[model samples]
Target chain A: MSARELPLLFIRHAVAEDSHVLGDEARALTPEGRAAFRHHARKLARLTPLRGIITSPLVRAVQTAELLAEAFGVSGVEVHPALLPQRGAHKRIVDLGRERGAGWALVGHNPSLERAAIRALEHELPDKLRKGAALALHPLKNGGFTLAWWATPGKPVKRPGDLR
Target chain B: MSARELPLLFIRHAVAEDSHVLGDEARALTPEGRAAFRHHARKLARLTPLRGIITSPLVRAVQTAELLAEAFGVSGVEVHPALLPQRGAHKRIVDLGRERGAGWALVGHNPSLERAAIRALEHELPDKLRKGAALALHPLKNGGFTLAWWATPGKPVKRPGDLR
Candidate 1:
């Protein structure tokens, strides 16, 4: 594809606060989670210049969008509850995707991510929520999203006797 | 890149407690921060399945790496001062990156990340480092590192205010 027709980034939120420690609406990213978040924030600047940032208003999503916006030198983001994946969430994003032309990221929680990643983009997925994972979705000129790239947070170097 | 060669993930540390609010070393990720971490931790699991974790002994790095270990299903990360950035940090990671041949993730700070990301992997940077950012490096048989992906934590993602 030409640089003119790039892809949209569908990023899963990075790490978040413990579910038990905080309510779904209030949970945030842990300290290490912050590192995990920054790791990617810096990394993204290296790949392609991002467009606009969007995410669920849920604490985790807001946090993710906020940090990303700050990094690429932006003011704020447009929050879309439709990205949340709750009941009736799909209709919101689906309709939005159809109407919107191009260049945007959709940030949200899982089950929705799992559904969108596999069903919409066709990327192989393991489970519902793969925190901090991102799928590049290109809404084709003809309609429908395309899978460009996928990334999960960290990977460990395995040594001898490493428990597989 | 081929299926045979595995890549590694190295993340930048999360934001510490507001510098004015807590001791620099004793700081931790705020409530909002934890949510971001969890979001990404889940994302890491779907990829290569982390084998081991590594980080500095500082409360922040340990805290960040720990969350990821749990999410990735690893017990905990082993620490090495050599990984710490305060004292000749870049040289240490350069040596460490040279020694590494497996899929691994190291949580540390930056500008050390620039050393780790640029020296270990071949990439063209697009922006600056904010609080939480990430970079992915996949080494080639020819000994060059490939910048697989990069991300920032916040809004106005790219230059034009879209998800390019």
Candidate 2:
């Protein structure tokens, strides 16, 4: 948000069922899942200065990504399949991230989401990310990004809210 | 959810603001607004089986309306301004409780929402309503509606893990 700081934020998809049974496309958030996003969004927005959001195309991921995008006032969400857990998906995502550049956010599936976050952090995965969790990182000039602190959804350890 | 309980659910639009400066067509959800809707959707879905959804044609209302419809497998969200909040100088609303003639889920704006909810109860008012609050009315054998419950959106709630 400030010229002094480079922008970056990491966010996970909302709760989703395991694959093979539902097929990602058929999946939709359960009522509780949607609400959880809302709850965390308020907290995320309060803690960070986010520019844009990139997310997976699947419904739950797309919807979850949009929650943070909306909270940050981003114009619209762009789809990136690489953020998916599927193998061989990151190529497109990396390309998309480069084109979009720094100061943006990534909203996507699990492992991929953590991977992208680490890639931004120069290849260091934060502790495991839970659904609806948001990790904010700062891309440093010396190469590799700085850990801006990975915060759980709904409320951060550093920032207090209704949850606390 | 049970055959004996026959429930009706109403979902409120998330954070939205009407600007005197802009025309109605241009108004849309604030970033926080969209988050609010997406946030609560999960919980609302859990409250009932989420059979159907109906909405007003207004853009902001409709956008917020679609999220709920999509989350619940509402199958379709019918747009009808008959449920809309009157524009600029007009402030009257139709009580669809008697007209709609049965239990249904509706998504729309204030006063109108309250009027619709109360019509099933007592059919009068200057009433009090808040953002993202919902109520249900049961249709009696005598063709009157009785108030079931009123629910207010909780700021932070959970997202759906999967549609069960």
Candidate 3:
């Protein structure tokens, strides 16, 4: 009913190992991280109908996107190097979502995910999202987007009643 | 032990009715909102030991802060006009926390809370917080602050194993 064209979900990868033994890119999600993702994925599917999934090439991010793809019944997930934490690929990712003409989920790293959101909405963030947390954004008629809601893993959503 | 000083928590009032017939400032938390707040207050108490509680004079905010004070076993809570949704009182509040040499919780309205976080960290936020959500910020060395964590009402806290 609203002019909001598409919805964007920016999610950070789940927990992973600390040792850079295999290099940061090679590190994967821990057992707990994987289990926790599965738990949260169910709730996410109920809240949003994910049409497409995109993620960074990093092992942990790839793994997180795959789980989401499975949960959302999307056949495949794409990997884009731009989703890496330090990359300046935020605008490109946002453009991709706008072109898709449907809701898409992007799994990436912190700072980057935080920055991407900042870029889209041009609003200030209080902090980097916790691992596995996601922010739902809707594109405004203007070039920017508005944050519709923020979900931290395992927490119920709360919105201000009269403040809006 | 590190250079990080006191952490500041910015929280919104719990659920409230949509009508402004009573005037926005006079509206109170709904029964469900009150119960939900009680549920979250317990979790907040376990996570951090708040040394001081500050709130807006608004009825909903005062109620929310009172619940937090009781849960954290803090003796009393104070009201600061700066916490109202439209004030530029963030720096003063930060100074207050630093002077006190302890972690303090600020409960207030949106836009202002969002603006304060953006000003302090100079980072863009994806969206204004929903009622009952909180962001934890740790000050940076050269002034300003870094977003440490963001917590939504129902999500279980999950941290990356190695990072934690």
Which number leads on DockQ? Answer: 2
TM-score for all predictions? 0.44, 0.49, 0.46
Give the Å shift of residue A117 in candidate 1: 2.4
lDDT of 2 by residue, B139-158 (tens): 57676555555555663332
Q: What docking grade applies to model 1?
A: incorrect
Which stretches of model 3 miss by more than 4 angstroms? A1-6, A158-164, B1-164
* CA deviation > 4 Å runs, candidate 2: A3-6, A17-22, A91-95, A158-164, B1-164
* Candidate 2 chain A weakest lDDT stretch, 10 residues: A155-164
lDDT of 3 by residue, B1-164 (tens): 32245567888888976644436764556657767777898887777777778777665676677567657766555556567655567665556545543388988887777677777767786555778987777765566666666666786643223123
What are the chain A TM-scores of the candidates, in order? 0.79, 0.78, 0.86
> Which ranges in model 1 have alpha carbons more than 4 Å from their true place?
A1-4, A20-22, A122-129, A155-164, B1-164
Comparison by lDDT, 1 against 2, better one? 1
Q: Rank the candidates by TM-score, best first.
A: 2, 3, 1
